[model samples]
Target: MKRRTKKLLLNWRIILLTVFLIGSVVTLAVRPLTFGIDISGGVALVAQTEHPVDADTMQLVVDSLQKRLNTLGLRDITVEAQGDQIVLVKVANVTTAEEADAIKNVIESQGVFYMEFDGVIFGTGQDVEYVGIYQIKPDNTWSVPFRISKSAAEKFAELAKGKTGWPVDMFLDPPVNSLLVVPDSVYNLMNSSEFNAQVPEAPTLLQRITKAFNITVVAYANQTADELADMAEGREKIVLVDLNQGLQSELENMNVTVRLVQRGPGESDHALIIRTLGLYGPYSVGEGLATGQPQQDVQITGTASDRLTAEQEARQIYTVLKSGSLPVKLNVVGMEFISPRLGENFKYQALLAGIGALIAVFAIVYFHYRNWKIAIPVASTSFFEAIIILGFAALIQWNLDLPSIAGIIAAIGTGVDQQIVITDELLGGTKETRITRRSNVLKRMGRAFFVIFASAATTIVAMSFLLIYFVGTLKGFAFTTILGVVIGILVTRPAYAEIAKYLLGED
Candidate 1:
């Protein structure tokens, strides 16, 4: 027995498993696996397009959203399209309700950018060729430099010829065929001198905006449903600024698409204009740009009160502009926030489920074999397989969610079943046959491996489809399941065969 034990420890198959076990531990320590929103608490948003799209268009949508989030330095995020219309956006480590809202806004931002001078469109997101990193200006404002296509540059130069000091309007995802509804107070502010400082030509800013954007305007003043309906007749929707809840609900009852925006305290006039009119800036055309030189480079500048805010604003702009525009707009259908406490509870529950699965498998195996030797090996191998799977996740930094935990359990159960097949093959035959087959351990294990390989292949194939075609949430489950199976086939199952051979004195 001592000789067999010594030989088993020295066996290369056993050593392979031992090396992986140690390596998995060390790798996990170096780079731990990141838990998903289900475990770490974050935001989950469901968005849908107005109409279903083709596979390529859906892929473009996913890529665009992914770029925006990643550019903002969000490391653990998933943006994937389900079917041809719905998209799931998930971000880990977002704990606050406010942060969730901010994420929704970012995801829904179509990133459509355009600039026009004197109501003549000159540039769009398609015109952008390259966007450089943002840098702080001497005036303590952030400026993002970008390059436009030569054709767009030339068009702008020709349009702005001999026309310096004129305002060039910049807009992002501006509404079309829409109406801007402001409260009486906000409408008065739009005409105020203080508001004029932020949005020059303020007294007539609304009319200029109405002309530039071709959007209708109306002010709320105890208007009846019919009056509101008349104003909304030719519009696709109504965008209200600082409007009361009563108006919003009434409009909803009228079957009108309405978007309500709350005006922030001391928000500048342009800010409100950007919200209601989609007009962010009225930047002045420079002499150099108006000289018809066909300048290809331009800068879009913004100022914030503090350095941190300036940096944040710069990154926000950079992220949007760099992502370009989505092929279709996504309307947020649902937003869910998972709290940290709930996340902790979920983690605890996942731990319990994994432990329960281990115990259940061990109990069933022990009853079937009536031997601790066989049952213990099965359980330990299953446990080791889990560690290897986790190590894979850590290496790739895959986010583990509840579905991923379920996949691990499923994989371990499959491991137990395959081990049983090997054990049954070894325990078969009469005394003479058993004696004769002692030297045939490799052949018996090989026979059992045939069945194991078939099953593993089948599971991996199914999960591969899920990984490629499914949404963000299901991808985690598919990935972990595939990882578990691969690890078992390559690492744990072979070692378990060696242990089984040793236990039966086949060595």
Candidate 2:
């Protein structure tokens, strides 16, 4: 082949590679993926434990939770221990109240293992038992397992008429504890005569079940079993109890007796007993238990969603309760749901902002290069980088929230900077000394790589911290930024360099 022809072939080869890279990005952009809060949201919970838990132990707990979240198929999830008693978790794409609640439940859940035989208690509470420490799903749901006593499992199953899995009613106890309930059908079959005699028309199955399985939850700060029993006098209450030394001390020192009161005639009344089992503090026990004394103490604030789904969410809460009390009890210091209007407006602003930034970059590159040959490649590379990022996001089903959008914009800038370097080096050289020019261009590219690498590393570090220390928007920005920088470095930069070199006949 002629020398010119040989050079042309080499150039075409480089062009082909760049095209392939760009094409792949295009394909990905058309179909992007995203992650959920469990996958990508930051969750920091400061639980007030009845006892002091060291940092190492807290880290262990967080690590366990992170594993659970990973099991759920979430990527980029981080779990860490903050201070002596706080566990911090950060994930991406947890944008809604429902998602946040779901993540919280998973982080807080204490899972237990149980085996049931027939409808009677057969073994001791600790036999062949495990608890769920954490569990996670790709869609951002996590469940943790812990050990439980075999006897407790049997008792719970007996109470639940041989139904065993996750005990819905045992959230107040350690995750390993069991709570059982007789189903409505069994109640109807067993109490038909009395039920019929009391009400000739008899209520529906649901009503009967509700009446038969009535339960109430209460929270007590510090009190012995005797004190709790005294408070429950004149009331038919199913008492869910937790004992910790710290809670006991707090109550005693404060001269406080906490009780939860529910007024209504029902099949069963529920009360929560918070006491110190040891010298530490009161560990939380009981699901759906009220906090404080009747008309006093800290109340379980916030209205719950209607039944069904709310109950399911409550089951998640129960899972956390089962896990055990947090290292420190955290009061809901701030609880504000993102309003729909605000979310919409924020999304709009983010989209517009990203578009504006991209257009500005494109204009600057086009005008600065002053040649369509150079500007085209830079612009194409920028566009290709975005497609790839978006495609990956869509393929992963990553939620394209506001912060993530910003990450995409930042990636665009990074891509542009790299492209500018490639264009400068390529255009400054000639075809007569192609090899020397190519060497110089590669050297320039290396310097750009160093800068890009450093920037990406710094961004990753910042994101990691935000992901661990903060929640909500800050976390979103961190996640998106990290992802964008990663994509820019790995996919976009090299492809643009190749394109620039090929265009300049320097390949």
Candidate 3:
């Protein structure tokens, strides 16, 4: 009996089963699994394009958005094109309202990028060749160096010839209202000798103003108040600026007045940023345009309170420069922010549902077989198949959302059904057939697997449609279901057949 058991354990089917079970357990314990937005809290947004677009164009839009969102330091993000012109976005772990709003603004708004040298439009997003960060100074303050198209570079060289010592402002959706522009001089000043004392509180100033104020405030770099007039339309716009005599005079001349309110820290809930170009005193490029060489590789740098903030700012700048602008405008039609607590509840309920399903399957299988030797292996094999499926999910970092969990349950049901077929074929025969030769048992198992394989193939064909055409939760369900079916046919079912043959003394 010991020799027989040893041979059974050494069988290829048993060996494969043992290896997979061990690997699954190790992967579950070590790597852990990534959860989707439905399991982990996050924001789900469905934004519709202003008009219907061709399939290829919609795909391009989705791809662009995916690339842009990836630059935002978010690892778990899904951007998929759905329906005629709708794009579905899911970002995990975005719990705070402030973060969600900021992300939403970025997602909904088209990033119109422009590079201006001394107020001349020299390049757009199309001209951006590359963007990256490099540490120039010994202090480890990083700089973002970007290259523009050769044509734009030549144009910049020409336009910048006379204005060698002037500042350049890079804008996203230019003019002013959007409040997304970075002056070339701010980069220098932040890296200069007087940075520590003159920079003010970088944290307090650089943060995107989250406080609610009565009047709308807009910030610009090089653009004058007259140029920003359209941004102030239909709203009470209050312009705020650093205590600059020249900027104040420019605003007065442009008929856009500046109002300075005196308030201590935490005094009121209202705050606005005007971010003037000349805020950091006069600093020039110093006849660098005298070189007049094509300014293809230009470095833009800025200050942040910490390394994390600097990385974020760099990524945001890179995204704006790279993504440029969406081809068509998008308006958010549906937005749902799932709280982590609710997601936790859903996860718990899903677990309970799976447990209940397994228990019910066990009872039904045991009652049908009326023998522990037959029912135990069947139920155990089904349970083992589930573990293997989950292990594969974790190994591949597939997010387990509610739909995925449902898929696992559904797959286990299919597995149990197949296992029952194998058990019945081996056990429920005439006395002569039941006591048949090992070769007969092998033939019976082959017949049972033929039925199993055919069923598995049909199920796979059905789920393939859902996996391909669907984009959201349904796709996940189909994926898990198909994966489970494949594993059942290839791995678990074969191992179960071998084990059942050994247990029934068919060998």
Ranking by lDDT: 1, 3, 2
**Local distance difference test, each candidate:** 0.77, 0.47, 0.68
lDDT of 2 by residue, 185-208 (tens): 333433343222222333332233
Number of the top candidate by TM-score?
Answer: 3
Clashing pairs in 1: none
Question: In terms of TM-score, which candidate is stronger, 1 or 2?
Answer: 1
Per-candidate TM vs. native?
Answer: 0.62, 0.48, 0.63
Q: Which stretches of model 1 miss by more than 4 angstroms?
A: 112-151, 155-323, 429-438
Winner on lDDT (1 vs 2) = 1
RMSD of each: 13.4, 16.6, 13.3
CA lDDT for candidate 1 = 0.77
Order the candidates by TM-score, highest first — what do you get?
3, 1, 2
Which portions of model 2 miss their true places by more than 4 Å? 1-115, 118-331, 429-474
| Lowest-sum lDDT 10-residue window in model 3 | 272-281
